[model samples]
Target: MSKVPDRFLGYAFCVGDVLLELDMDFHIISADGAIKNTLGAVNREQSFLDLLTESGRGLIESSVKMLTGANRLGPFVISVGQEGLAKTEFAVFLAKLPTAEDRIYMVLSKPYRLGKSDSKNAPAQKTEDKKREFFNRLEGLFEGNPDAAENMLVTVLEASAGQQLDDEKRLDIERYLQSFSVGGAHATQIADDKFAVVHDKTTPKKEAADIAAELARATGVTLKGATIDAAEAKLSETDSMRALIFSLQSFASGNEGFAVDQIQKNCSTLIGETTERVRAFREVLDEGRFSLVFQPIVDLKKATTHHFEALTRFELPPIIKTQWEMIRFAEDIGLIDEFDYAVVNLAIAKIRKMLKKGGSPGIAVNLSGRSLSNQGFIFELMSLLRGNKDLKQYLSLEITESAKIHDLDLLSEILDEIRGIGFKVYLDDFGAGAAGFQYLKKLKVDALKIDGAYIKDALTSKEDRAFLRSMVTLCKDLEIVTVGEWVETQEHANLLREMGVDYGQGYFFGKPSPNFLVAPTAAAS
Candidate 1:
């Protein structure tokens, strides 16, 4: 019998998720407690697929093959049950762990009952699927139209001085873009920090104008004439459609209007704010003027703290009180990577200390959006991880989807390098914007921290519940472990558990604190 690595066992306990390892021959190499408790002991020689429901075998196997290849497909949902027992479905996320031997590693979601006879779940699933379809069509309405010039009106707010928004502010802007639907105006990201709103001719020009005012008020950003009718572009007999689009690109560049003056005012305000932030950021860097407090992520099924998310706090500079303000300002000034590096180092230091004292709970540290595009910082990060190989499994990096990722291919390569060091990466605050799904498709994230809004309103709002169910179902289908943020009560936790949310974080579990360690006596109690 081959011995399983202690590190992998520690990983299973920290994630509160099942771990399964299979060889190239489709035979199980090992199964952790979660698997054993769910599916019973496994024989090493038994084929892994034989355990799955007959209907799901082929799909699961094919998805696994793609997962092992460069063109990896996302997670796959499959049912595992005996003939007499009702089938249970799980979303399974897989990764090829770097090892001397060829093997596939799986992170499995908790089982939820799935069958047509189950009346309780039928309507929710059906409604969510319909909603997803509607949104898909809405997205197409914004993106799929070939002759948008005829029916669509466009407005773009360009980023100045290579500055982009952090996730919170970007989501705020996206929300405002969709909030006013005068004559069914639809909004989509045509480019990074550049959004376009489209409405048919039926929409009154006044309503579109109101939308611009609404946007300006909501975001406090000035918009220049950047508006154009979809049909305004002249077609030439000699020029192709591509040439017409190239010409239209000039129209999108900028415009002349009162909004320009207001934008300059906004920029002036921003400049003053940026200077203050830069001074504060530098002081923190030189003096180590920050603190880290951890908020617990609870496993609903076990009612235990599976991990803690390290949150940063700055002091003495009354101007930068909130973590969001501090982080967002750092992002605006190209100092985010430095801030993220400091947080990661602090988190890793604490995590290492905890592990040495005989505890192995995981810690999730936030990585600022700007760090994704900074190759030098990424190289430094990779080197940092390589030097602390033992801490990899205990450490996870949380990347929020608030800002536009400038270079995804480069980010992907950086993540791959980090993953090669054995650490897990989580897509944090998912379902907040369009980028969530895009990142899911492009990256190899091990888990997802579902956006807090869905969890906060899930119990009271049917719409929120449906949205959550849909998001959880999507994550399950991809096999990504899910954590619900902003869970405030036992009722909320119980509701999320029923909905198949793997983990949760909120005041219901525990509050963020500087002293968040899992003491020996505390665990025993």
Candidate 2:
């Protein structure tokens, strides 16, 4: 026996929404039909039935019965059509259906003549006219009685097929069927007959049908089927082949072609706008349209300077007036990484230059979670440090506590490797979110920078004070130094010092300055 395609067990019943899953273990009947299960299991059987019950299939059946009588096939067809519409409107709904089953029963009957045939360019014109009239009737039927729409649609399908449709003609018919089956605003476009009904829950069935018909008319192909054994056999050959074939057949041809053209139009417009923004950001970076600002860290006991945190400021042109505006534009155009990398490299170089000129205070540079988690970036930082030995001791790598810990083992190993070479690691914004004391022990960092939120409100709030104190004690136990950030006044600094915080950073000492300076003896004292 020939092997089945991997998706052979998956099948579509109704045009847009009636999908069925048939594997050895259990048979699953689904509406809003998209193949979901490649291999059936018993668990999936119960789940499918449960899903149908939840979708109110019973209610749908009752409604169809009221309109189409007890034959059930009529109601079943309408329910299938309704499911088609549901699939387009609700992504969540479609996601629930089994996508890998292929036991589909497509109904194709002889084509029905609506009017007397004309002989003038008759064959081509007749096909167009027939499609237009058929879709128009379908729209009216769907609007008037959605309960009976599926049955009527099936009736239309049965009436529309000529004795035996060639493969190309059958594909066109299938696309047309799918368009109406998956109804939404896009359904109205069925008149165009160029696009395939690639399922987009948001599109109207009429529009989708028009596009599908046109595409089907363009590309001569018909619906094809595969059994479970065939699909599994294909998987053994190549995993990508199935996905590739589906994408090409569904999106690149017939009714799908029209929909893709529309998508391409929208994408092109977005691409153009994004391109302009990217170009503008590149110009700014190229011209060094940014400045480095330093914020002072104070020593409470001596009322002296301890260190400075480097902050980046973009010098916007008159056209780009706001900091947020520039930043948002950069993010939208994929220039965020470029801008951040430039800031990092520039800050490092600036710190090195300042140290060479006898600047004494330690300088802290912020490293985004993205950069820190990147192995290439860590190596780059190491290379920079290697080239500038004199500034190594005075530099600290500040990282956010909430950054995703990508590959924890690798991150710990890298931290140890960097620390081994004399670079200090400070967990910035520590005690934020769910960051626990365990991270302090596990990460083996040199220091923890108390989140600014704790310092800003800890003075007045008992709860905040207790939390900060507990965190400070925890750090102490682990031999990890603690630094209080956003210290705004002498009282805040004094309170932090009393809490055992070894360092502080905020506006109280001095605002960020371009000129780097040593810690004043008074502050250190």
Candidate 3:
């Protein structure tokens, strides 16, 4: 056996969903600089949990052995089935890696597939059949009406290209064919290729391997072996790395093929799973799994607490570990509306709790544009508020300026109704949206929260400072209070104060806390 190169030896594998197959590749670089590759296929029909567990264990052991100098290895690259597949695969890979192998690099690649073509024997008869069908259809159309020969030719041209004929081209082809028919040269004018329909199908599987081999040549990895089962490969010291390379290549190609077939077979199943997850999340909302965290809004002039903005935190499943992941999953599964509604209700509940405890601080909660546009959501919210008069007094709704208010008339009517009910409205992230000024008169908002992007660099950037100053002036003229967010230091706070910003919020005042009522004596005053 030839010794593989030092640079190519590594354990790399692609991960995919249950119904979608996964392919893995192993590249082995022997001590003598010989490159060898191997391929692996993960069966999607089997239990994903069990397969993943086994694969993860193998990965950890291999990585540890490499790191301890028991074996030599290179970087591991993974290609996944879908968008979130990358994150899930990484998480599993991370969990399985030994502590000593923490420095091992991991790379992610875009999804790809192996090419498959029809059998050679099958194509000859199919092509002849299509040719007969085409000529027959053409003859029938022309014989029905001599004057329609032009239209029939245009149809044949479109059919050949596998697309609809444009009006101009159709008319031109019609005229040419009509001229030939009138001159009695139609039969002789037909080209030999025109009688037969040609179909350019994808290349065959073996041909695809050759193409992949060419690609691997550029990467300095050689195709060592191709097998149906990667795990069956002999894991000797010399062959281990080669096996890994072959596995990765097989996985990349096979996964692409599997993704298409799996989507066709189980698209509804996937959709149902997504819907169930969303439904479960909404159920969690109804069960009050959400809690409110408050961040202080400071009155810049008095240097005291103006109000507290309410943010929602959810107790997600172990699968969802990070804040971004949880929010993204919710958004992906179409549960953003439910999530936003839960946040509002949770914030309202916290406000009620605060009021009962004899602390009457103003509470602001964010409302998504989708929620605002939903008549049912607005009715449910209003009903909740009307049922509790005391909670309504302390409630303030903050809406992002970037929200696409599709039905402006309906939105304006809704805003009017919301104001009529005595709930204060704040236009969140002002200056971020194009029509911020235009919305001022249209929206019956009581406050404007300047976007954090503007406030963060206001002092250093003259343009930002000027924009903020102009915004402050515009708000004053309109009698709408302005609040600056992302005030991180005393300098930021001071500048906002000097510019007559009505309120400020960010790290300077306090970070978002689970306990809403905790306040310094000076801020409380």
Candidate 4:
């Protein structure tokens, strides 16, 4: 706590938005507003910066250096410290009082009310959905997808531009730049002015610079920026995620190659072990040793199979991994896309065969969101599916939210194209992620599979049941079907049906087996 000017105190008191006072070290001195209701309990001992996620922290840290004359910090579509909200964006405004230069003031504003217009009767929604789903999806993504681990080239580019453009145009350009993906690598905006590109090991340093240059031009201003490359770094086995994130933060701060050392530290064992696993995994993909299992999603009203979801099962010796564990490993090694293509091809072939039997039940094959991020993969998948467009009725695509899709708008467009070909698309594990609401807004899907966790808890927890009922009502309003998973008993099914879930799938229904009646895919469980 420090002395503050009376005029500044008066202004801070009158400000209706969430406000915070921070020392020069960015430690909280004071706080006001309903922040505790959303973000969490305010602890004055904590660094004000600690409240922010990595990217959000990076944005502030980057801006701090240029704050000498600037008072206003952002209207950046900045993600706040809060998790699991329907909308993650907050419009941030930061200022430094002329008389009290030792303290920085921040205000956070957003459309935060849940299903309300700020009336007297309106109440706040529970936070578990936002918190649990955020951590769950992040854990799912952090574990990696089905692929081998390899050295990667991570490059950070910090630019000076966009001051001349309007906020919407600037955000649009940022989104466009963030869409840059090569193979398994994707670009993420660490700071409003900084973009970090994670590229394949084969990507040259010069090539990474060129990517920065191209994106820099998209800012619609004469921007000059420096690119730093953390070339050929092996993330540490024990703390790979922390090391990776810290490295990005350092890069955003214009630190030298110090970022690489964090990841490279104690990574030798990881390198040797992963090399062998990568080899074994590649062989599995090549050998075509996987089998297909079909789990029927039953329509609640009709009590019949609406469609069957195709799942993968691996058959191998020694090293054992669950379906998702293998998928994450594959994603880590950057070979999941190849595995995805193989599965889709097999699915098409099977659909063609089923069509040969005169009357065919439709099959939905899971496609990793990571693969969809790659334009090359999307183009190839579209080409392959278009070639077998006649099987569109018998085949559907279920988007597995295994990885974040960088260009969601592009994906929505592609999904529309696929649906135009008469293939239904379903979003998997809906409401199991922080971005589900954003996803539902952007994507036009025929159906969504409610996360199994929600379904498992629905019968016991009134909160869970309430959320499901509300979700089901929203889906019905949108004219979209809903599927509940992990249904183990008749009671569960009945309750879900009463809540207006259109379909259901679980062990109570027949479990998945090699009922595809054909040779299975070349890769993965």
Candidate 3 RMSD computed on C-alpha atoms after optimal superposition onto the true structure: 26.3
Model 3, 197-237: lDDT tens per residue? 11111112122234225424443222221212111222221
User: Compared with the true structure, what per-residue lDDT tens digits does model 1 show for residues 41-160?
Assistant: 567887778777653665455334433232222233556654466656665555565443377666565433222332224343232233223333333333323433344444445544
lDDT of 4: 0.61
Q: Rank the candidates by TM-score, best first.
A: 4, 1, 3, 2
The weakest ten consecutive residues by lDDT in model 4 span 516-525
Models sorted by lDDT, best on top: 1, 4, 3, 2
Q: Rate the local accuracy (lDDT) of all candidates.
A: 0.62, 0.49, 0.49, 0.61
User: In terms of TM-score, how similar is model 2 to the real structure?
Assistant: 0.48
Q: TM-score for every candidate vs. truth? A: 0.50, 0.48, 0.48, 0.52
Best by TM-score: 4
C-alpha RMSD of candidate 2: 20.5
What value does the lDDT take at residue 73 in candidate 4?
Answer: 41
Query: Where does candidate 4 stray beyond 4 Å?
Result: 1-265, 317-320, 357-359, 516-525
